[model samples]
Structures are given as C-alpha cells and as structure tokens.
Target: MRKTKKKNKIYFPDPKFNDSLVTRFVNHLMKNGKKNIAYKIFYNAMKKIDLIKEKEDKTALEIWKEGLKNVMPHVEVRSRRMGGSNIQVPIPISSNSKITKAMKLLISCAFIRNEKTMSNKLAFEIWDAFKEQGEAVKRKENIHKMAEANKAFSHFRF
Candidate 1:
C-alpha cells in the first residue's frame, strides 16, 4: 500500500456504564465538540430507559447494547463499476462499521423525530430499538433484505 493505515484511537468508557461502546455512541451523538452535552443526553436517556422498562431483567446498559445489536446491519450494498456498468454488490460489514452505521442511523432518525428534546427523542429510539421496532431497526432490516435480494451479485465484490 502506498499509504500507511491509520491507527485506531482508544476510547475511554463513560462514567455511568463504564462501557467503551457507550462512549463511542455518545461521541457520535456529540455535535460541535459539545461532549459534555452529549454525555448528559446519553446518561439521561439511559435513566429514562431504566425508568420505563422496569420489568426487564436486563440493565439499561444491556438493553442499550441489545438495541445497538438490533440495529446493526450484517451486510450492505455498495455501488461498483465493472465493464462500463454500475452494479450493487453485497458485502459483509466489520463489527466496528456495523456499530458506527447503527449509531448514525439512530441519531439521524432521532433528530427527525417530533420530540420536545434531542435526549427524549434518542431515549424513545433506544426503547423502540430494544423492543425490535423503530426506524433504525427498520432501516437495518431493509439493508439486510436488500443484501439478500442482491446476493446474486456477491461475486462482483471487490
């Protein structure tokens, strides 16, 4: 390779959950370098989740992890050009990429939601994902379906 690959930076876990994944999600949720605000929103959402899903045996962090897993897409289609034609090729995604995609989808959907605040919208999205119903989950399902439908093009993967 002409250029060296960039090294991955280590992420410190959030205070409440002490989980690196939560820290990553909060980092993605952060805007304009407002990390404190992001942390507050994420913690508040987790608290709300705990308050609402009292009967579940899982902790709020575990529920959030499940929600993240629910929204993670295993395969995705990418446009590739070959023989003067463009084709949609299904490719497996790495775990980190899957997590990142899920986080982005969740945040985007949360932003579009008609909620009083960003934290509330994010909390609702997290709850819906945990229950296996939400825009983010639907998006993941759609991605999987698309990948399955285009499985015939798997041979075209670069």
Candidate 2:
C-alpha cells in the first residue's frame, strides 16, 4: 500500500455533551463548510424534541442516540463484477463506519420531511427513530432486505 493507510484523526467531543459521536454527527450534517450551523440545527432539534415529546424518562440526547441506533444498518449489498457479469454482493458492515452511516441516514431522512424548519423535521425524525419507526429506520430495513436478497452473490465478495 502507498505510504501505508492514512491514520484516523481523533475528533474532540462536542462542547455541550462532551461526546465524540455528537461531533461526528455534526460533521456529517455540516454543509457549505459551516459546522456551527450544523451544531445549531442539532442542538435546536434536541430542544424541540424536549418540547414536543411528553415523556421525561429519556433525555433529548439519549433519544437521539437511540434513534441513531435504530437506523444503523447491519449489512449492505455492494456491486461486484465477476465472469463478465455484475452482481450485488451482500456483506456484513464494518463496525467503525456504522455510526457515520447512521448519522448520514438520520440527517438525510430528516431533510426529506415536509416540516417548516429543519430543526422540527430533525426532531420528528429523531422521535420516530426512538420509537423504531421512521424514514431512517425504514432505510436501514431496506438495506438489510437488499443484502438478504443478494446473499447468493456474497461469495463474490473480495
């Protein structure tokens, strides 16, 4: 390999929660190189979630984490070419990138909602994820389904 594999940089935790996962999620949410806007959207969504949800058993942050867990995909299908034919090969997902994938799905599904503000949409999606039902969770389920359907090609995995 050229110059060995690039080292993984460590990310400092987010200010409010002191959690690196939050920082990673914010990084995924960032656009136009504006990380502050992403943080604002995330924190505001937590606040909105607090106001919208009646139960006080779980904190907003915990609920968000739960939502991310629900949306985490376990397996996926990757395209591979063999014998002059392309196939969808199912494979188990790597643990390290799982959180990033979940974060990306959460942000994308939040954006698809018809809510007035991104915060509200994110809050709703987070709440739905906590309940194990949401676009993001549906997306995870779809990924698993696709992987299962493509299991026949799993041997094609390199």
Candidate 3:
C-alpha cells in the first residue's frame, strides 16, 4: 500500500562501450562497492573475447549481448495462495526484469567457472552462453521448463 512507485535510477554509459547496458552489467558484477575493479574486470573480459571470438562479423560487445539475450527467461514461477492451497503460478516477466535476471545469472555462473582469473572465467562464460551452452543457459532452460510445467496454474497469476 505505497502511495507512489519507486523510480528507476539512471546509470551512465560505460567509458569503453558507451552502453548503458554495459554499465548495468558492471553494476551487477561489482562487489563491495569497488566499481573501478568491476569495470577493469569487465573490460578485460571484453578484450579476451576480442582475442578469441570465432565470428569476425560481430564485435565482442555484440557477442555479449547475444549471450545475455540467450539467458533471458520469458516466464518465471511464483507461489500464490489459491483456495487454501499454495500453487506454483507461471507469470510473464517484464523486459527490464528479464535483463536484470539474465545479467545476474550470467555473472553468477561466471564466478563458478573453472578459470585462472575472473576476466578469463567471465569471457569463457560469455562465449559459452553465446554458443547457447553454459550454466546460465541451462538455468534459463530450467526456468522455462518450470514455467511450462506450471502452465495450468498460470490462472493464479497476480
């Protein structure tokens, strides 16, 4: 019962890519308020992608975008009370939330990758995602499967 909705904060585009999305991704990647370190890691990962990319037609940033898109989930499941019973309801996600979730998943999967450095791990994760074969992609697929399984309960969406 709030009187007003919270406003979204504005983020300036990153220095290297001039993309607000990149800024948002770095914000998600950031730890302990060390934005400079996060930016360094992200930029380094982009450089690694540039060195190892297979598709010459697309840039590193483009590959990252595609990978993120691949990880974005269209629907998600939530618990809802219906007829004195809890039901898993499938709900459509908004575009902004989809992007946020995708970024978080990508970063988290990158952290779990077996690599020498954060940059290397992130670069490999991005490449794997771009190829549609990575933990992030798998997580997205799992979410889709859950949503599909609970399609009958979609009527309970709030």
Candidate 4:
C-alpha cells in the first residue's frame, strides 16, 4: 500500500445517550452535511421504538443495539481470481467490520422501507431487526449462507 493507514479518529458520544455507537450511527445517517437533522431523525426513531415496543423492558438504545447485532454478518464471500478463474471465497469477518456492515445494511434497508417519514421507516426497520425478522437481518443471513455454500473456495482467500 502506498499510503500509511489513517489513524482512527475518536468520536465523543452524543448528548442524550452518551454513547459513541449512537454518534457513529448518526454520522452514517447524516446526509448533505446536516448532522443535527440526522440526530433528530435518529432520536425521533428511538422515541417511536420506545412507544411501539413498550412491553419490552430494555431501553430503546438496547433494542437498537440488539437490532444491529442481529444483522451482523459473521462470514462473507469475496471474489478472488485464481488459476484463471474467479471464485467466491468465504472468509471470517473482523468484529469492527461486522458492526460496520450491519450498520450499513440496516441503513440501506431502512431507506427502502415504505413509510411516511424517514424516522418512521427507520423505527419500523429497527423493530423488525430486533425481532430477527427484517430485510437487513435477512440480508445478513443470506450472506452467511452464501459463504457457507462457498466454503470449498475458502482456499482462494487472499
């Protein structure tokens, strides 16, 4: 690699939750340089989740974390070129990468939800993920299944 690896920047936790993960989520959710708007949308979604899942004893943040975990992929397949052929090689994912992938899948799936508002869509997706039955969760499951199916090509992993 030509460039040195960039040092990871430290992110201070958000005001309400005092959690760095929440800040990271909000950062991913941010668009057009509007972080406050992203925070508002996330906080509103959390409030909606609280109201919708009232029977659950856990806080909204806990639910959100659980949802993220549910969508985290343990293994993924990558394209590898070997012996004049391309192969799908299964590989284990690092913990940090799993979290990043889960967050990205959740955000992308939530964006496609058919809801009146972004907050409502995100809240609904989060609730579904917490139940282990959402598009994002399914996507993760599919990724793992594909990796398992391609286990014979694991030797091709670069």
lDDT of each: 0.89, 0.90, 0.95, 0.93
Model 1 residue 89 CA deviation (Å) reads 0.2
Among the numbered candidates, top lDDT falls to: 3
Steric clash count of candidate 1 = 0
lDDT of 1 by residue, 13-89 (tens): 88877888888999999999999999999988888888889689998888888988888889999999889998889
Higher-TM-score candidate of 3 and 4: 3
Model 3 worst lDDT run, 10 consecutive residues: 1-10
- Distance from true position, residue 88, model 1, in Å? 0.2
Tell me the tens digit of each residue's lDDT in model 3 across 1-158: 85796688798999999999999999999999999999999999999999998756899999999999999999999998878998899999988899999999999999999999999999999999999999999999999999999998887778
- The residue ranges of model 2 lying beyond 4 angstroms of the native Cα positions read 1-3
Q: Can you tell me which runs of candidate 1 are displaced by over 4 Å? A: 1-3
Pick the winner on TM-score between candidates 1 and 4. Answer: 4
For residues 1-158, what per-residue lDDT tens digits would candidate 2 score against the true structure? Answer: 55786577698999999999889888888999999999999999999988977855888999898889899998888888888988899888877678878989999999999999998999999999999997999999999999988888888887
Mark the regions of model 4 whose C-alpha exceeds 4 Å error after superposition.
1-6
**Which candidate achieves the best TM-score against the true structure?**
3
Model 3, residue 130: displacement in angstroms?
0.6
Which residue pairs clash in candidate 2? none
**Model 4 steric clash pairs:** none
